[model samples]
Target: QEAKLWLPSAVPSVSRLTVCSVPVVETEIKLRQYRCFESLASLRHYLSLWTRIVLAQRAKPRSHHWSTRSQKAFSSVRERADDTAERYRRDRQAILELRGRGDWEQRLQVLRNEDVLSADPGLL
Candidate 1:
């Protein structure tokens, strides 16, 4: 009778349930592993993207054109400054000739008086 009970066909209900639950446990474990791998893949993608951006910023200009452009810009600015200074010098020379020996304030006062006297009295 004991040998008959020990046969595979006569296994206890508890052992049968344990055998059936094994596949469910294995499926859960596989699902967890898949989630972990997905998370790692996402992290790797972000890291690569960040690295690309940083490297692009750190990369130096490869051509001489950039330096040439900067030099041209500086020369143009210098030319403009020199032109403005020359124009100012010419204007100052003209003003000095017109004012003679008097300072600018005296010249301005005389000019203002002359303008008042020159205006037509009828217009006022």
Candidate 2:
């Protein structure tokens, strides 16, 4: 013979495959599947607690409670509130100024002179 090749006479067969469970990973998966709170009361309690915590953090929101995006969102909300307050102030001042004018002042005087208690509100 010029050449010869060696080969196994018997072939090995796999019987069973065993899967090991990781405790930490299994626990984490279970935790994710679990319900957040048992009852509505507990949910409400935690919400109130979180509200208090958030309120406490409002003064200086540089803590872990606030992320950069959340801080920016709160800042925008604050800015909108300030803008609304300023607008309301300006509107009230304008209304007051308008009421101090001739016809409006006369009408207010007439209403004041009349019996407000007995006066028909619809006509006024």
Each candidate's number of clashing pairs is 0, 0
Candidate 1 collision pairs: none
lDDT of each: 0.39, 0.35
Across 1-124, the per-residue lDDT of candidate 2 in tens digits comes to 5866211111111211122234533443233223211222333343344344445456566756566655565455445434433443343333333223454333222212122211223332
Model 2 Cα displacement at 57 (Å)? 5.1
How many clashes (backbone atoms < 3 Å, residues ≥3 apart in a chain or on different chains) does model 2 have? 0
- lDDT (Cα, tens digit) per residue for candidate 1, span 1-124: 3544222213344474455464644443344334434533443443344344334334654457855765565455445434433443443343333333455434222222222221233322
Q: Which consecutive 10 residues in model 2 have the weakest lDDT in total?
A: 7-16
- Best-performing candidate as measured by TM-score: 1
